[model samples]
Target: MGSIATRGDSKRSGNQGMIKTHSRSRHKRAQALAEMAVMVPFLVIGMMGMLDLGRAFYYQISLTNAVREAARYGAQPYYTGLSPACNAIPPATSPGASCPVPGDQNIKDRLAQELSGTGFVVDPTKIQILPDQGTRVSNCGTSGSCQYALKVTATYQFTFITPIIGDLIGNPLTLKTSSLFRTEY
Candidate 1:
């Protein structure tokens, strides 16, 4: 009888230990779930913000490159969109010659073509060939001869993929980039 009682008592003790372990595991799982519930939103938002930032940076770089390319093209000695009599500037001696610098409309069109699928459509009016400075005498070779400096600027409105980030900061950030170059021709 004493042995039977001792055996029964040991069995009850083992069952209690198992129940405690099971309850502890359940508690741990619930804790982990709660932690995840609290952290997942933040993690998701952070990831989204990172993505938006990357997109903005990429667009900025693309815009800068595009403007730089256009500026380089514009810097070449080109016509001033004038008639044949006034076509040649100091650099261009030949009348009605093909100038390195293209017309404003031409440059805008070329830039638009270059930025196709880049989500940018450059406006000709917005592109400044050389704002506040035009047809300056070239410091390059001779004082008599003239050289041109070209500057191109473009502005883009960037919209975030995630509206939450936009709400926090601001929706549709205006991104502007410019490129400056000296005329080679």
Candidate 2:
């Protein structure tokens, strides 16, 4: 009878040890959940920041390509007539005075067209044509002949989706790109 009572007591002690192990595992699980809960917001914000950065980079590349296209278009010779009358002009004559160069509005239109479908609201006012219209002239040595170059510049305001990061830095960051090309006339 004494041996039987001792065996029952040992069994009860073993059951108590199992309960302690189960409770410890539960506590560890709860601690892991608490840690995850504390870190989730930061992880989410970091992901959002990365997304915004990628968006900004995309916008910048698109803007750069648009500017380059606009510059290329502006630099090319545009002849409206069947025959190129501008090509026969005297070497001493100024190209801007006789040749038909692409106006600022035309360049802006090309830029806008390139930027279309990009989800960017391009302000026409933000586009700048250097040397303006009817002034495409650069003095070339002492020959008195003019060399033409077109420069197109555009600026876009890039707003981040992450408000915290935007606020920490500057909201609506200005992204500007410019392209220069010599005339093919």
Candidate 3:
């Protein structure tokens, strides 16, 4: 409600100067709306990027578990193995008599299959087993003297919600995990 208008004889007539009619600027309101619209996409993209990173981290963890399972199976010619897959590297038990398990490819394939069964898509071909990489030490006199490693490297494709990075980064993201441990056998 507006203040009481001053009468010719009003004592407070001097204060009337402060009162004014209400006015709204369309330009200012439009500018504010435009600014909000412009900032929203950037804010959304940032949030999506954060979400993508979290997914990547989770994938890495699951991939690690998958590799562990495969490595455990491949190690010691038995189960229950090491964290760093290298520890599980099949020892030169037979000294190159055509390994019973053949090469470490079986380990990588098993891991990929398990991961896929668990609803994870990964490239198993990227897996690298140091066990088949041959002995690290050259000219070993004894069969058990040399140490080997089993490495499982996996690459994954990540889908993004925001197109902000889609054009810039072709294809999905790549995540790799590897473990190395000594063979129990």
Best by lDDT: 2
lDDT of 1 at 149: 56
Badly placed stretches (over 4 Å) of model 1 are 1-5, 77-100, 117-120, 123-125, 131-144
Model 2: residue 30 alpha-carbon error in angstroms:
1.0
Please give, for residues 2-95, the per-residue lDDT of candidate 3 as tens digits: 3344454363544454332112355667888999999998898889878866766777788888877776655544322322343344445443
Q: Between 1 and 3, whose lDDT is larger?
A: 1
Worst 10 residues of 1 by lDDT: 131-140
| Residue range 36-117, candidate 2, lDDT tens digits | 9999999999999989989999999999999999999898656555345665642445455455667789899999999897
The superposed Cα distance between candidate 1 and the true structure at residue 31, in angstroms, equals 1.9
Q: Which of candidates 2 and 3 is the stronger one according to lDDT?
A: 2
Q: By summed lDDT, which 10 consecutive residues of candidate 2 come out lowest?
A: 137-146
Identify the runs in model 2 with alpha carbons over 4 angstroms from their true place. Answer: 1-10, 79-99, 137-145
lDDT (tens digit, per residue) of candidate 1 on 102-164: 656666666777788787565566666663332432233443334455678888788899888
Candidate 3 — worst ten consecutive residues by lDDT sum? Answer: 15-24
lDDT (C-alpha) at residue 155 in model 2: 95
C-alpha RMSD for every candidate: 5.4, 3.5, 7.5
lDDT of each: 0.69, 0.82, 0.59
